[model samples]
Target: MSEHEGTYRTFTGKTYSLYGINTGTNQYYKVIKKLADLFLQQCPDKKRLLFQIQKASVNRSFFKKRSGKNINHSLISFIKKTLRDSLSVYTAGVKHHLRTLPLSQRFDSTLMTKEEQYHLYMLEIELVNRIYKEPFKSSQYKFALLPHCLRDFRPDCHSVPGDVESVCKECTERCFIHLGSLLLKKYNIHPYISVTMDLEKLFKRLKAEHPSIGALGVACVPELVNGMRICINLDIPPVGVPLDANRCARWMKQACESSFNLKMLEALIK
Candidate 1:
């Protein structure tokens, strides 16, 4: 892994923080890619493997059902063993976060995701990027949805409505949304500040307009995986970069500053 000093901050997450693994976030990406390559070697079918990983990651009951299969069992065991000491540091707060999660949000499956699921979700993102990167690049119309939380919290965001979501007005040079927007535009990818709650509806409408559409997302792990799944079901090739930490208001009492790996984002699209 590149030991180059990463721009990762020490910001903590209610459930996970990539910086927890090491001062730099590059190791997280490296580890996930290694694990993904190993898993793919066992099941050459990338789509089928992604499905199995996603299913096992979310429902413990479903995971148990597949335990009879050596591949399934080994995949879970391997991920748990391999990630426990490294990437698991990022998810160390998951148990506490789940215990203290408000009763009102108990039904929110994304908020209720366990530590192991977070680890699996990291692999899922890497796998999806590998599967869709080419299609996403060749897509006639490509766009990225950046979480609004990535905006500079120091100033009032000047984002305005766009064709599908809120558009960054470049109000602040230091804002991640602004910086990311600039990088994405270089690759002809439209970047929007994600504010829409009903992604299914929004994606459906967008798909109708751009049949060869591809999507890229920047969000927390669970949310990023969920969005990628939606795009897949809608026949939109998807790739994503998860936030370095889940420090938004949904995870904390108040939204705190958060960021994603800009270098990783460029690597995915470019």
Candidate 2:
């Protein structure tokens, strides 16, 4: 196996101050590859690696010829095995604690297809039943009734930037908790919630036009009132966000209720 060469250059002065083993040369690549394999195993969110299938598949950036004897191009292939390896350790440190949640999370219409919406509704009912009708661990624990927050209404659960399957099971739980609280308080019911109402795959359920499926996968759109802007990027994992002009335009027309027309919004796109 040929060794991979690594180089470094600073195009942007913004260097990540975080520290980790960088596979900056062929020797380190060999060790890094093995370490990365184990690193994936040790990583808490191994399932997240499923999101990196594309990164792994098109992993040829390491093999490109360099100009100098050791290496020519000053800039390193940021996408090489080194970054992925370090990312395993570096990525896992993020911690997200839900400050407040609303009752039954909602989604932008474009990101959500009619089918997914239907499924989630059904799931909500079933899970509520289990919480109320069939007593479970969650109910007896004494969950608080909390007011709706931005994170609660439109949650970027998976934290992936643009993948269609933006909903997270954890976020689903938050939705139910909100609904359960409302039901319990209003109706004096046992507070049961449904479990089944399956979650649909992001790509299959929605038309490819959803902007939430494009730049912001399940992103929390800022609610700007009185000239105050608050944008919260769950800042989870990065994922591929593919977009089409026509699809984007059609999506805005449907989702935003003519409030936004992507085609007409020239500055926004450019």
Candidate 3:
């Protein structure tokens, strides 16, 4: 990890952006922003959004000294503008303040609360559903729809609902396929999608060009199997071309050794 560059920026810079991954840039961000906006549009009425963001609780020192300018400004401006009229532009792009909004600021790569993480996961699912037009209410179809999402393999549509492990594997396989479908539908060209960053010039120019809401994955490997198995292949340090990202061999092997620390802090003053 660079001592100077914050993890969030590093991660953002390093993160496998969906835009250039496959599909067109416009197609990519539109679908992501559309669903992300859906979750965030109704955010204000419920205190959950604010509380969730607060729960993330980023420290100021974590902000980078230099390059953190864009995202930091973007985030603050988003907060201010969203405060103004979170409801008005909920539908489509209608003078979103993203351009006028500060494009840079500084912050840490903080861990979002379970609620924030849950919303992220929800955004991920919505991304797939929006692109594929999958029925939002049912898991049965999503399980089957998963295979078609990934580009590489298309497992014959067969429902395995009983065994947890089999269901989990199927769910992962299908999600990847669906992601590919999303890109293809959006871009109309066979754009290469990967969990690795390979932007070249596309990554640098796009954010400045348009505004968007960030999301994790539905088509991503960190998928939900039978609505239970949350498989996240957390990586080690030194971001480079992933030889086998999903196969985070060391991370997977030491699963039990690694602790999942969750602290449930309740209101003291309230």
Top candidate (TM-score): 1
Query: Candidate 2 or 3, higher lDDT?
Result: 3
Q: How many clashes in each structure? A: 0, 15, 17
**Tens-digit lDDT track for model 3 on 32-108?**
44545654675533234433332222333443443252333544345434423422222222123222323342121
Query: How far in Å is the alpha carbon of 152 misplaced in model 3?
Result: 9.5
Runs with alpha carbons beyond 4 Å of true place in candidate 2: 1-57, 61-72, 77-205, 208-270
Computed on alpha carbons, the lDDT of every model, listed in order, comes to 0.85, 0.23, 0.26
Taking the tens digit of each residue's C-alpha lDDT, what string does model 1 give over 210-256? 99999999999999999999999999999999999998887887879
RMSD (Cα, Å) of candidate 1? 2.7
Best of the two (1, 2) by TM-score = 1
| Ranking of predictions according to TM-score | 1, 3, 2
CA displacement after TM-score superposition, residue 219 of candidate 3 (Å): 5.8
- The C-alpha local distance difference test score for the whole of candidate 3 amounts to 0.26
